[model samples]
Target: MKDIFSTIKIQVNEKIYVKDPETSALGRKIIQESILLMEEIGFDNFTFKKLGTKINSNESSIYRYFENKHKLLLYLSSWYWSWIEYKLFFATTNVDDSFEKLKKAITVVTEKIVDDKATAHINEAVLNKIIISEYTKTFHTKEVDEENKEGYFLIYKRVINRIVKLITEVNPEYPFAKSLASTIIEGSLHQHFLRDHLKTITNCDEHVSPTDFYINLIITVLKK
Candidate 1:
């Protein structure tokens, strides 16, 4: 019964930020309130100037941490995937059945996020809203290749890698483990986004559980 988060660190790459937002009060406030404000206004309209105003600080102060909102988004995304990877590991660690482990991982990612008091400084539930709403923007840029080389996405890569391993465990002969794993991860989150906006386009029904469709999706493909 080890407290997994207590023993692990969510490492956002140094290249992504000028200051580690976890280090100081102002830094932590910037992260905490940034998650709040991003959820409130959406990432496209979010600005350090507005954030500074809300936090009662100078806009220039945000640069002491992030170079710009793009990098900030990446930092938030990295933290999220790190948290997710931890959760997936924690959720499935003792399961003997590979397919069951994979199902649990899918549920952890595709389902609702609950606030964990262990990391009270962060409201992961609100952060998941931003993540589901905006995570793709973190890499849909010209600099993605260079940033990839800097190891800016290792945690994200690791999550996929872990899922891929589970996929292989379930069907050692399967040739599409990586592809299927990525599809489950990205497709499930994308469906969650659609559930909020174009509910008609989504297969998930709230009364049945937000994760039901996605869990069925991966299980069907993996078991087949």
Candidate 2:
């Protein structure tokens, strides 16, 4: 039999999921339905049994792919970070100007996501909402230290590292490149949530888009 896992396009680390959800129909169903179930019902009420029922599969079948719901969330979040890094890579690669490259990369993260069909099982749009609301839970848990040691955050680290490199290229003397990189990524995620749900608290002005605010902030700080 041909190996389906080998053909799966997205390069999420094996540490994220118990099994590669892309390798089999049941696994794919687990990921596809879990995203909708998590988004619709909220992660607090989402469960393996509920997801299984939604997919017409059993709880154990879903467990074959993910250890538990937290792992499932981690898997989705990892996939998203990996997807973001891919978007950043392609978006900035052809640009010769360092400032333009930096601005373009910022746009990729801060701008609203359009539906991407390349990774069909995971709805990037819905998943972004889930990430905004639930991604922190994956890292803020008691087991986070253990998970971090396992390279569970490689995709996020990869994305931050790339941004840090770009910042260094633009401002070689910047002492806080990595710190600024993380601030942009994490702060942008939270700012996005605030902009949508608690508009008054966000740093963004009504006249400027969220992407504009983030791009301008980074440019002002780094383009010395």
- Backbone clash numbers for all candidates listed: 0, 0
TM-score of 1: 0.94
| lDDT (10s digit) by residue, model 2, range 1-224 | 01432244777778767789988988887888899999999999999998888998878988888888988998899988888887888789879999889889888887777667666677889999998889889899898898899999888899999999998888999999999889888887888888888988876655666788878787789877
RMSD of 1: 1.6
Residue 207 CA displacement from its true place in model 2, Å: 4.9
Off by over 4 Å in 1: 1-3
Clashing pairs in 1: none
Q: Give the TM-score of each candidate.
A: 0.94, 0.92
Clashing pairs in 2: none
Over 4 Å off, model 2: 1-8, 203-207
lDDT, each prediction:
0.86, 0.84
Q: Candidate 1 lDDT, tens digit per residue, 73-162?
A: 999999999899889888998899888888888788778888766776788999998988998898888989999999988899899999
